[model samples]
Target: MHEERPEVGVGPWEGELPSEGHYDPELLSNGDRRNVADKYRYWSMEAIVADLDERRHDFHIAIENWQHDMNIGTVVRTANAFLAKEVHIIGRRRWNKRGAMVTDRYQHVRHHPTVEDFVVWAKGEGLAIIGIDIFPDSEKLETYELPRNCVLVFGQEGPGLSEEVHQNAEATLSIEQFGSTRSINAASAAGIAMHAWIRRHVFDQSV
Candidate 1:
């Protein structure tokens, strides 16, 4: 559940209202943004993020950003929704943020110049790294035992996991594929892998 904070008055609105304003004053005056869930309505970005940080999940999310994939934003948004511990970007310095809708501010994101840097960090943190790919000799994600505390790694949209990343993975698992397409979208694949981890380790009532 989300927690709400009391609003702090920064200042009064200064501009005169336009005849045909783009946004509703009632919503804007109350800091209500329709892009977020109801629980976050009328709350400042910092407040929402603080609330999320207080109850974030254990799993981390990492994506290869070599192609400037727009899907990275979607992945970040999903990670925020699921309350991931953190989001890591590997292989590129910049990614398209338009799709994230500024949700990145509410999610902790780290950047690694290469896959090796990410692997090193994961090892130091004692977090297992699981690669999501459809390579030969890879295990089926459905049957694999996902770690309760781990980094879920995903590759670029078309090329999939780089050789170094595939080799560094504690284990590589593939989602079931049946259509003519050789693989699914990277963002969609990430959502699947994250949910699998959640179902296996998190959703269990005894936890």
Candidate 2:
């Protein structure tokens, strides 16, 4: 026989129910089972998004999805954790969200049909486009001083950044590798890049 699954989050509001506008009536009456911060356990989804918008980091994250990369979901989840301004998806409209585990519901995700459109949008937003990939002119990501208002773009799992994106990028950065593998995972690269930004701007730590 299969084991019974344990429930997540809190079970209903204990004692006096809170009357805050952010609190969801249903979740308070029933239970808050969504994977969220303790403070936001009973908050409505819109409230959580609104609060996040007020304090989202200046840096943005973009990923290429020409081949329907599965890593985008993980990238979104990481972006949410880091409170990224937004996640830009270049190429396909739909991507595999299993890795995100429903974090997308609280994170703002935008889609671009092509690289050209993405570049146009980034330029309009005054965000520098920094690509993460290994190329002849790629600089070490560790040494790179990521712009405060910029979008760190990553290619799909296999091909890396497309030629168009590479050409349009302000700088293509590469994470230093030690052992056998030539490159790291796309989602992993995104996390590293996002943390680098956080270290630089949020905690005022050198990357």
lDDT of 1 by residue, 104-175 (tens): 988999999988789899999999999999889789998888889899999888888888989998999999
Candidate 2 is scored at a TM of 0.95
TM-score of every prediction relative to native: 0.83, 0.95
lDDT of 2 at 104: 99
The deviation in Å at residue 171 for candidate 1 is 0.2
Per-residue C-alpha lDDT of model 2 across residues 126-205, encoded as one tens digit per residue? 99999999999999999888899999999999999999999999999999989999999999999999998888888885
Q: lDDT for each of the candidates?
A: 0.83, 0.94
Positional deviation of residue 120's Cα in model 1 after best superposition, in angstroms:
1.0
In Å, residue 159's CA in model 1 sits off its true spot by: 0.8
The worst-scoring run of ten residues by lDDT in candidate 1 lies at 17-26
Cα lDDT for residue 142, candidate 1: 87
